[model samples]
Target: DQQVKQNSPSLSVQEGRISILNCDYTNSMFDYFLWYKKYPAEGPTFLISISSIKDKNEDGRFTVFLNKSAKHLSLHIVPSQPGDSAVYFCAARLKAAGNKLTFGGGTRVLVKP
Candidate 1:
């Protein structure tokens, strides 16, 4: 079973537009959520995170919202730019699990100028 899932394999958005990526988890024990952006062969970079105690977290152009009650979450990028083109992975970790993460397959985002 997919503990974490990003249903859409890819998404394309016009530069300066809004991009929304969705994610879902099946485990109720997951309490910490994170979104990582990866470019090509490099490792993923932490973009934003939201703890189970909170519903929303934002950083500049990126925002992450968590709905623990529904086992779902999403990442929103306002004014999406070419620099935002990459693979976004939604990850989760249980606080009692020592922070080891379970990552989704990933969703690739492309920004058209």
Candidate 2:
């Protein structure tokens, strides 16, 4: 099954705190992993990514860590801000699948100021 799952549909955090979002996948063939952030009524923008060959990737305030053996991944945002409130989607792609990505439903985060 190609289910890229984000178990929690929503999260809330106070500004300046750390926000963590989790994702899990069952497909062993997935090699490329990506995370996207979206605002209301807008398309998702790429956040960070990690390959099956690596365990962690970080970009500015955002960081992503992968545990290949466990089929788990997590995104961490440090010093979360009110503007950071949005929906985050985790995606994966199998090279054999032609780079087509399957996305998780999404997790909505609200950073309260």
lDDT of 1 by residue, 1-113 (tens): 88999999999999999999999999998989999999998989999999999999999999999998899999999989999999999999977877789999999999999
What are the TM-scores, per candidate, against the unseen true structure? 0.97, 0.97
Model 1 residue 41 distance off true place after TM-score fit, in angstroms = 1.0
Spell out the clash pairs found in candidate 1. none
In order, the Cα lDDT scores of the candidates are 0.95, 0.95
lDDT of 1: 0.95
Q: lDDT (0-100) at residue 84 of candidate 1?
A: 93
Off by over 4 Å in 2: none
Which TM-score value belongs to model 1?
Answer: 0.97
In model 2, what lDDT does residue 21 have? 98
Q: For model 1, give the 10-residue run with minimal summed lDDT.
A: 92-101
How far residue 11's Cα lies from its native spot in candidate 1, in Å, is 0.1
